[model samples]
Target chain A: MREVVVPLAQRSYTIAIGEGLLDRRDLLAPIVAGRQVAIVSNVTVAPLYAARLRAALEPDADCVIEVALPDGEAHKHWGTLNAIFDALLEHRFDRSAILVALGGGVVGDMTGFAAAVYQRGIDFIQVPTTLLAQVDSSVGGKTGINHPLGKNMIGAFHQPRLVLADVGCLATLPERELSAGLAEVIKHGAIADAAYLDAVERALPALLARDPGALADTVARSCEIKAGVVGSDERESGLRAILNFGHTFGHAIEAGLGYGEWLHGEAVGAGMVMAADLSRRLGLLDAAAAGRLRDAIAAAGLPVRGPAWPADRYVELMSVDKKAERGTPRFVLLEGLGRACVRRAPDDAVRETLAACAPG
Target chain B: MREVVVPLAQRSYTIAIGEGLLDRRDLLAPIVAGRQVAIVSNVTVAPLYAARLRAALEPDADCVIEVALPDGEAHKHWGTLNAIFDALLEHRFDRSAILVALGGGVVGDMTGFAAAVYQRGIDFIQVPTTLLAQVDSSVGGKTGINHPLGKNMIGAFHQPRLVLADVGCLATLPERELSAGLAEVIKHGAIADAAYLDAVERALPALLARDPGALADTVARSCEIKAGVVGSDERESGLRAILNFGHTFGHAIEAGLGYGEWLHGEAVGAGMVMAADLSRRLGLLDAAAAGRLRDAIAAAGLPVRGPAWPADRYVELMSVDKKAERGTPRFVLLEGLGRACVRRAPDDAVRETLAACAPG
Candidate 1:
């Protein structure tokens, strides 16, 4: 098992990555003991691991309630979030009750958000099943649902009590989902660690083949990099915006294509490509580094280009993005393979990137 | 002008109480200067004050948008909250935009909650137009919408950047609403200060008549008490629960009668009476002290007795309250006129209080 602690003072918790952690009752006992525990998972992931999690928690948790949310990013809305609220309310879960997120990013974001607002906040544990979640979303306290107009428009910064990332769960992840997870893993490397990017490129085949050691190593490294960024700026005031390097354009893609059409990581994958191209165009990153990032993403089986759309449509969507300040979209451009900066680009320059990367 | 500072470290803010502070753009300029401002008011209060607030903010704010929500507690649900979000997204409000809650508690709560979650938290100033909000909801960071199962079931503790409590607005407040506000005023005294309670009782007629000095005095005092409690325990972990002095039963009344039927303060008015009775029954509070508290509630022209509901109905409702722990409702009962404590009373003892206070 590998452990990474998010240093958020009182809000901090440890992320544990290993095999068969789904059945690790000893790990979950301290938080849920004598308390009613609600395991919120998506329908797809629920069947795969809910029973094992329930069996693990059933011994000490006074009551283990299972709430299977409809799976997919499209269902990440207030109505879907209400399902978790309904289950908890129906069961009379109180402020002291604990919520365990037992699935992928959608489940983790929604569950963390529900914990954020339920009775003015409560404790929650993250049992991220998808690589995207284990490496990125689950570690940071950023949790929310998407609005029709924007992705992740509604949310809160509610940290988890514990994050149990069973890398073994990746064996069952869809090939497409696995690549989506690699987008963020690649992002962690692209923004902070050049050597890790090289290691990831070398390990891509093993990672795609579900090699446990490679998966655990990358997951731990990605968490460490992300934890370092999030630890310094939990609310994305300044330095933390680097974590959204691909997210600005990626969120535009998600909103433009409609949420769930392309997984968040897929949008981010193509988004990172667009950002690198823009970075190269702006004279910050060289062409070779941009090509290297694109190759890594493409080799991971992720999209390297955005869906065909007019520059205006992408700009309109990006303008409403949470990253925008005073209606101007702030792009997280790469300064180099291991450095990122947030700044607004000229309209012609942004339009050029949109035309080249997302030709209609 | 009278000011009380809520000392919450970096989240600390000032509560300004005076005759015509609502029109004081100088106070708001510090927070809203150069930022796009959204003045969230209800229909009733919007027509009355939104324009004035917009005018006050228009001079300094880049753009002042008005979101007139439906009035009353019934509108304190997600749908109404969505209206604020819709307007924000429609106007392309960014994370840097400021939300100025310009109505009563409902507007303050929804706006504060929207600020808490809109783009994962933003700055909001509370220009509470009602006494209930000025003294209670606006001071603390507790902001949320109600779930169908319970009052304030879904919420977050997102504090405001500044609270502008203009007592002059009380002159336009209806008689019943004024009484409702007094209930919380009495509670502030009942929970923490006997001298303040005495002052409130002595000046009941002046308060009822909307005396500016009296209203400002009481509102300032109540804010001081609440700020003191919240300063110590911001999350209601321990000492803060005492602030919910009558909220356990109050939430039950509000939930039982259905929200909007009894204003939160009205229900709390009756709730305080029931809590006094429960305290007397438990021998924690003497009968004379309980009677004096009941008389004060009645003197404020607020309901001293609950609506005729079966004890079991109240019990079932209270059991689901946010204050409950593991399905057992915790009551904040008085130890005397100026002190309160949280504990669970025997079922029979609780039933006796309900029979004595809420006969059905």
Candidate 2:
């Protein structure tokens, strides 16, 4: 077992990574013991894990409540988020109640948000069951639902009490979803660590093949990298924007193709390639480095190209992204293999990159 | 002009109380300069003051957008909040956008909440038109919409950059509404300063007659008392709960009668009386003190008696209040002329107070 602490002062909590941690009553008890506990998950992940998680929580929890939302990114809106509130209110859960998020990114995001706004604010624990969530979504305190105008357009910076990343749950993740998770894992290396990127490239087969050792190592490293960035810039005022290295373009891809058509990480996977290409075109990154990043993304079985859409349409979608400031979309481009910076590229350069990356 | 600074560290803001502060460009410029400004007002208040507020903001703001929502607490739900988001997104307002809440408590709350969640969080200025908002809601960082189950069941504690409390706007306030505002003003005195409560009782006629001096004095004192409480306990962990002196029962009154049937302050007015009666029954307060508080409420033209509801129903509603812990309703009872404490009362005593205070 490996534990990484996200140092967020009073809001800090540990991310525990290992196999079969879900059944570890010893680990779950301290957080849920004698407290009203609500386990929020989606239909897909809840059926597989909710009961076991409930079994572990029922022993010490004052009472256990289960709220299973509809599955998929398309449901990540106000209407779906309200279901959690409806259940909590129906059960008459008070401020002292604790919510445990027990699914992937979609579940984690919605559950975290529900906890953030429920009775002004309350405590919540993250038990991420997907690779994408374990490394990225579960670490940062960013919790919200998507607006029709843009993805993650509404949210709060509410940190969790604890994050339990049980690797055993990853066995249930579909093949394509696992690759999508790797997009963020790959992002962790691409934005901050060159040696880690090489390690990921070499361990690609082992990670894809569900090797426990490889999966655990990458999740820990990715968490540490993200926690460090989030700790320094908790509100994303400055250094935190680097974490969105590919998100500006990735959000455009998701919105353009209509959400849920491609997984978020899948969109991010292709978005990173386009960002690197843009970096190279501006002479900030070499062709060799850009190509290397694309090869690793492709080898991980994630898309390296977006849906064929006009450059103007992609630009239009990107302009509405949360990362955009005053209608101008700011791109997060890599100056090198291990360094990322946020800035606005020339209109022509952005258009050319979009046209070249996703040829219609 | 009187300014009280809410000392909340980085989230600290000033509540500027005076007549005609709404048209003060010097005060509004620093916050709105070079930023997209969204003036969120209700249909009732917009036709009255939104144009004047917008005119003052146009010189410094990049652009000023007006969003007139349906008025009243009945509309303080997800649908109304979505309208604010819709307008902001429609105009492509970015993270740097500043939301100006130009109405009473309902507008202030929804606008503050809209600013809190829009693009995660953004800057907002409170331009409270109603005396109720100026004295209470505008000073607190609490922002959220009501859920079907409970009032303020969903929200975030996102403080504003500035709070502009224009006493001039109170001139257009209805007689009942002005009296409703006095309920909170009386609460501040009842919970924190006995002398302030005495002053309010003496000045009731002047306050009712719309005397600018008396109104300004009460507003400033109310802001100071509320600010002191909020600064110490921003998340309502301990001391802040005292500030909800009558809110537990008040919220029940609003929910029980159906929201918008009785104004929030009117319910709070009657709730305060019931709470005082409960305190007296609990042996924490004397009959004379309770009567004095009730008389002040009555003198201010606010309700001193609640609607005749079954004791069990009120008990059940209070049990779901945010202040309740572990399904037990914690009462904020007054111990003396100007003292408050939170604890669970004997069920019999609570029932007795309800019967004595509100007779069908």
Per-residue lDDT tens digits for candidate 1, residues A86-125, read: 9988988877899999999889999999999998888999
The list of candidate 1 runs beyond 4 A from truth reads A308-317, A351-360, B308-317
What do the candidate models score in CA lDDT, each in turn? 0.91, 0.90
Model 2: docking quality category: medium
Q: Write the per-residue lDDT of candidate 2 for residues A1-360, one digit (tens) a residue.
A: 999999999888999999888888888898888999999999999999999899999999999999999998889999999999999999888888999999998888889989998888889999999999999998889999988777788888889998989888999899998999999999989999999999999999999998988999999999999999999999889999999988888999888878888888999999999999999999999999999999999999999988898888998888777677766888889999889988889999988888889986
Candidate 1: what's its TM-score on chain B? 0.97
TM-score of 2: 0.97
Clashes of each: 0, 0
lDDT string, candidate 1, B1-360, tens digits: 999999999999999999888789899888899998898998899888887778888999889888889888778999999988999999988888889999888888899999999999989999988888888887889898988877778888888999889899988998888888899999999999999999999999999989999999999999999999999998877999898888888989988876778888889999999999999999999999999999999999999999999999999988777667767888899989999888889999999999999998
> What ranges in model 2 sit over 4 Å off?
none
Question: The CA-based lDDT of model 2 is what?
Answer: 0.90
